[model samples]
Target: MTQVDKASRKPCIALMGEFSAGKSTLANLLIGSDPLPVQVIATQLPPVWISHGDAPAFRVDLDGNQFAIDLDNLAEAPLDETAYIKIFCDEELLLQCDLLDMPGISDPNMSSEVWQRMISKADGVLWCSHATQAWRQSEAAVWASLPPDLYQRSLLLLTRIDKITSERDRQKLIRRVRAETEGLFLQCLPISLLQATAEQDDYDVWLKSGAEDFAKHLVDLLHSLSEDGAVGPEGQSLPEAAKPLRISGLVAPDSAPAPPPAPAPQTAAPQIMPRRVRLSPSPQDRACARDGAPGRPS
Candidate 1:
């Protein structure tokens, strides 16, 4: 794609994991709204492509046809024929990027083809593995098949981290996943998605839940993709070489330096330099010049 085309299209981040890995919960937390139904019943639904807007919901069939669908009745969506469901919301996060909430890779009720079809559409992925059973062989097998380009932009999230109980165990799990999946993901983080979502009003709780680091990295990723002049390996832009923004306490600290000012706007279109004019002296003037006098030729 051309640079403009790549820049114009919002980066698509796919959320993939095993069953009940808290993918939906992370989606809800990042979006700051639950556009998709988060009930157990809705877990079995097809991939949901969420973008920014106030448009009504629709489902895309395998043949690339769109049909209007009701959000309340999404659980009834036909799994076999549907390619993916499209959801739009006026959330701030959606304004920066799109989120694809994919089904579990090992869902017995749903065919692997269901999510496999949608993987190509992702610019990045957040692969959620349950903290208790982090980075299983099955997860690794599937991740191995993905293109290397996606790996640079992708992340491995150990969800339900609160269940791990001990800091030592948590750190050990993080180290183990990082070692095993080295170069496969940008970073491996343990997160309590449930706590992050529940503690929306409490910054300290949110940070403790591991949402703060996740959010910072996420924003950096999106900003990199948006500002980079060229498309990155997976069509997402990699982070620029400059220093990253310093975030503090769930927001920018007052002491932090402000972002550089925008360039001054040009008030007028640039004027083309006039082509150099060669003025041939008029015949009379030429004669007078030859005569070395200021009057007409006598």
Candidate 2:
């Protein structure tokens, strides 16, 4: 085995979730460009590791053999032999961190080995769960097996919030998710990736879509992870204003409290803050939540 060098690595954030959980859309929103084709994303592929550079796209095999690959035809990479596809982009967001877009955890067609082998490469994770069926047992089980330190650095995202039509149900879902996942992540945010992508220039739409808050939180997470010395280059210290509130604890509660009944969603939009990435963006099912609410298995 060759020695692994950690002195010059940037923090890597992995985009992970069940199939169609908006992981690819989140990747596109962050990059501000569609590097991963929608058709390719819809198909099963190994982890696509994206970094900041102008290098040509390439594929690395399980045995560490490298070969150039056409970015236009990503579907040709052999799933059984390929380790990951290394793609470079000049996006500002990539300057701060590398994004590893992993295959869907729930895809029956793809073996877990494809993604499991890549988890060690991540400094943090953005676990996307579908709003209608958020935080299933399988997701929690997988998360429980990951590095415990990641709980402080990671986030739980409820994607496709627009599917829940009523404001009452939306707030109810968000609050419940936050409560249930209180100790598991930095924050649990709700977002509609499609809405954020479609209305990137609209400030109010960004706020209402939950993208604004997600962006700010994401930036903060990057800073926190970098400052905490998680594979960040030297001389990078935590800024005075960037002290994240989530890094102080790693204690998981014995049990999360049951979420209270639904409150009417706030009509006022959250204030927006500028972020490097335009697209920004958790929970379990329980009986308390109804009408497309998440209900954790009893």
lDDT of 1 by residue, 1-298 (tens): 3445546477788999887777776676565555765344444789989887899999999999999998877877799999999989775556557889898898888899999988888778999999999999999999999878888888888888999889899899889999999999888988887675455445466567886667656656666556655343355554453223221112211122437656555996655432211111111111000101111100
- Model 1, residue 240: displacement in angstroms? 13
Q: Judge candidate 1 against the unseen true structure and give its global Cα lDDT, from 0 to 1.
A: 0.69
Q: Which lDDT tens digits does candidate 2 get at residues 183-265?
A: 99999999887776555445466457876567668867887666655453233543443333221001111124536546555
Q: Write out the backbone clash pairs for model 1.
A: none
| Candidate maximizing TM-score | 2
lDDT of 1 at 269: 60
Q: Model 2, residue 53: displacement in angstroms?
A: 1.2
Residue 181 accuracy (lDDT) in model 1: 92
Clashes of 2: 6
Looking at candidate 2, the ten consecutive residues that score lowest on lDDT are 289-298
